[model samples]
Target chain A: MNPNVPDDSAAASRYAIEAVAEITHVSRRLIVVYCQHGLISPVATPEESGWLFDEEAIHRLRHIEHLRTEYGMNMAGVRMMLEMLGELEQLREEVRFRRGG
Target chain B: MPAAFKDYYTTLGLSKSATEVEIKKSFRKLARKYHPDVAKDKKTAEEKFKEINEANEVLSDPVKRKKYDELGANWQDGGGYRPPPGGRAGAGHRADGTPAQEFHFEGTGFSDFFEQFFGGAGRRNYGFPSGEQEFTADGGAGRARRGADIEGDILVTLEEAMLGTMRPISMQTADPRSGKAETHSFTVRIPAGATDGRRIRVPGKGAEGTGGGVAGDLYLRVRLAAHPDFRPRGADLYYDLDLAPWEAVLGEQVIVPGLSGAIKVRIPPGTASGQQLRVRAQGLPIGKSGDRGDLYVVSNIQIPTEMTDAERELWEKLKVASSFDPRSDSKT
Candidate 1:
C-alpha cells in the first residue's frame, strides 16, 4: 500500500483534522503524532482522506491537555507517561477483552 | 435603630482596639482571596466580596465606624430604628422639642444609621444646623472625593488575548445626576499581552457621585480561558509540537501551531521528544512598549503503530542496521 494514499474507512467517519483542531486547540500534526505514538489510537478506519475522531480521542486529548497545562509535561514526558497509563488501561481491558464485553 | 453591626471588628477578627493599619492589611489579604472575581464559588464569593467591601467602607473611615460602634447591637436584628425628629426628618417626637434619640427597631444597616446621623457630608434637606456644622468641618467641605472604583470580570482565550480584543461589557449604575438606575453598555479595549490581575480602567463607568460629584472609574480584572495546546507563564508562551519518528531522526521543516495561526519551524536532526526551541517575540507583548515575550516550542516524536509488508521489510532491515538502544538502563 502506498503510504501517501488515503485510507477508505475514514469515509464512513465524520471528524477531520480541522474539526478536532477547532475543538481541542491542538494542531492536526500533534493529533496525528499522538496516534502514531500510541498515546491515542484512531478508532475509525482510514477509508477516506481524513480520519474520524471519537469521544474517547477527545477525552485522551483532554487528559493530555491537563498534563501539559497543569502538570507542565512536555510531549516526550507525555509519551513516557502514557506508557505507564497504557499499562493500567491494558490491565483493565484484559478483563473486558476476556469477557468480550 | 436597635443596634449597629460590628463589621470592622468582624473583618479583622479583632476588637475595636485593632489599629487602622491592621484592619487595612487584613482587608487587602482577604480581598485578594475572596474578591468574587478570584474566588472559585461564584455565589458565595460574591457575597463575601460585598461583605468585605462593606466592612472596609466602615473601617476605613473613622467617623462612620465610630457612629457605627456607638449604636448597640439592637439595631441589627430588627428593633431600634426611630427616625429623627421633625415632620420631614422622620424623627419621632413625643410632644417634646428636644430630639428623641433612642432607637427602637432592627434590620437597618449600621452604615445607613451612621450616614443618617452624621448626614454624610451633604444633604441640605434637614433643618439641623449642628449636623451641617459638624459635616462641613470634618474634611467634608470642598472635598472632591473620587467615586468608588468598581470591579468586573472578563474571560477570554489566549488567541483573543494575543491579537487584542474589544468586548462589550454590561453594567448597571444608579446615576446620581439623574437619580435613576441606568444600564450602560460599552466596549472595553483589551491591550495586547495583558496579564491576569492587570486592571483596565474605563473613565466615567463607575458609580456616580452625590451632590454633583464626578463619576467613578470602572476597573476590569482579566481572566484567561484554558487552552488545549498553548501554556503561558508570565510573558512567555509554550507549546508542544509533534513530529513523526522520521522527522525527529532527520531534520525537517515542521508546522508549529500558535495562538493566532501556524508557522514553519526547522527541527534539527536527531531531535528528541521534549527538546524545546524558542521563537522570540512571539508570545505576549510588553505593555505600551510594543515588545513581546518569547514562544518556546517543545518537540514530540510520534512512532507509527502498524507497518505493511514492504514497510515491515524496511523496518526489519533498519532494525538490524542501527544499534541504538532506546532504553540503556534496562536490566533485561
Candidate 2:
C-alpha cells in the first residue's frame, strides 16, 4: 500500500494485476502491455512475483481506455495526449494559483 | 419527454448553405476554442464543447444533414414540428419490432437531444459499446457487454482535501426500458491529497448493464471550492502575512491559519513586502507517502493610513532620519 494514502481500510486495499484487470475491464494482456509501455508503474510483489496496483492505477487505466476506445487513438497517440493533458492541467493549476483561487 | 428542436447550423454559427469544407473549418475552430481541456473556464467550456460537438456530429454528416434539412423552418418552430412516424430518425428499431436496445450517454457527454435523434446511428457508426449484450428472447448465449461509465463533478473544500472525507452523491438517470428517471445515491470516499481535476472512480455505480452484464463505474472529477483565506498551489497553500513596518524590520513570530489549525510562522528580520516565507511540511498532504508540501506566507507590509499628530511627527522624524531611496536605481 502507498504510505501516503490514509490508513483507512477502504483506501488501503491493493489489487494484483488480475484483480485490476477484472475491475477495470482491461484484459490481462493489455494490462501487461500498459506496464511494459511504461504507461503505468505498478508496485512489484515480493521477489518480483507479480504487480500490485492501487486505486490510482485503476483510474489511469480507465482514462487510457476512454482515450483509446472513444477517440480511436493508438497507444502512442494516447500517451501523447495524456502528456499534453497533464501539462495542460499543471498550467491550469498554476493559473488558478496566480489568480488566488 | 418532449423532444426539443435544435438548429444545428445556428449552433455552429454556420448557414444551411455552408459547404462541407466550411463546416469542418468552423467545427475545428470552435472546438479548439471551447474544448474543456484547453479552455480557461472549464465548466462553461465543457458545456460549449458538448453543444459544438453535437451540432458538428449532425452537420458534418451528409445523411444527417439531408434529414435535418428536411425539417427546414419547422426545426426552429419549437413544438411546431413533430417528426413523422417511421421517419429515418426512428430507424434504429430492429426489423422484429422490439424497441431498439437502449444506450445511455452518462459519460459520453452527449445530451438527450443528441441521443433522441442521432444516438443509435452514431453508436452503430461509431461502434461505441452499448453497455449491454443483446440476446434472443429464449435466453440464448450472447456477448457480454460492459456498462456505460458515468462522470460528474464533486466540490470539496480545502480542509476536506487536507484530510480524506466521505461525500454523499446522488444522480438521476432515465431507465432505458421505461424512460422513467431513476435516482441513485451513494457515498464516495475522497482520499487525502485530492486536487482539482483529480478523478475518483466508484466501481459498479454507473448505468446498469443489460442482459446480466456488470454495471459500469462512476467517475467524480474533483473541483476545489474557493478559499477565502488561502490559495492552493499543487500541494502548497499560500496565505497573506500582514506585518507592521516595525515587525518587518524586526523579525516577529506570528500565528496564521493553516490547513489544520493555527501555526506560528517566523517573519525574518528586514523582510520586504511581497517576500515569501516558507513553512516546511505545513502544506496539504501529498499522495499516501506521509510527506507534505510546504506552505508559503507572502508578506504584505501595511502602513497606517490615518495617524495621530504624535505618530505623524514620529513618522516625519523617521523619514528625515532615514536616507533610503527606493527609486534611486530607476532610469526614469
DockQ of each: 0.01, 0.16
Relative to the unseen true structure, what is the C-alpha lDDT of residue B139 in candidate 2, on a scale of 0 to 100? 36
Model 1 chain B weakest lDDT span, ten residues long? B122-131
Model 2 pairs in collision: A3-B288, A4-B288, A4-B289, A5-B288
Cα deviation of A92, candidate 2, in Å? 1.4
Top candidate (DockQ): 2
Error of 1 at B129 (Å): 28
> What C-alpha lDDT, on a 0 to 100 scale, does residue B307 get in candidate 1?
76
Candidate 2 local Cα displacement, residue B205, angstroms: 0.2
The segments of candidate 2 whose C-alpha lies over 4 angstroms from its true place after superposition are A1-13, A43-50, B1-142, B287-290, B303-316, B327-332
CA-lDDT, candidates in order:
0.56, 0.68
Query: Across residues B1-332, which tens digit of lDDT does each residue of candidate 2 receive?
Result: 43567778998899889997888778777876875546899889767776776677678667778877876544545553455666544423444555444433333345556555654223231111422234355332454555656555555666677887876555556653677876555566778988777767666666565556777766666666445467777788888888999999999999998777789888889999999999999988897888888899999999989889999999899999998888988957
Among incorrect, acceptable, medium and high, the docking class of model 1 is: incorrect
Question: Best candidate, lDDT-wise?
Answer: 2
Candidate 1 lDDT by residue in tens digits, B138-159:
6335554333334444454465
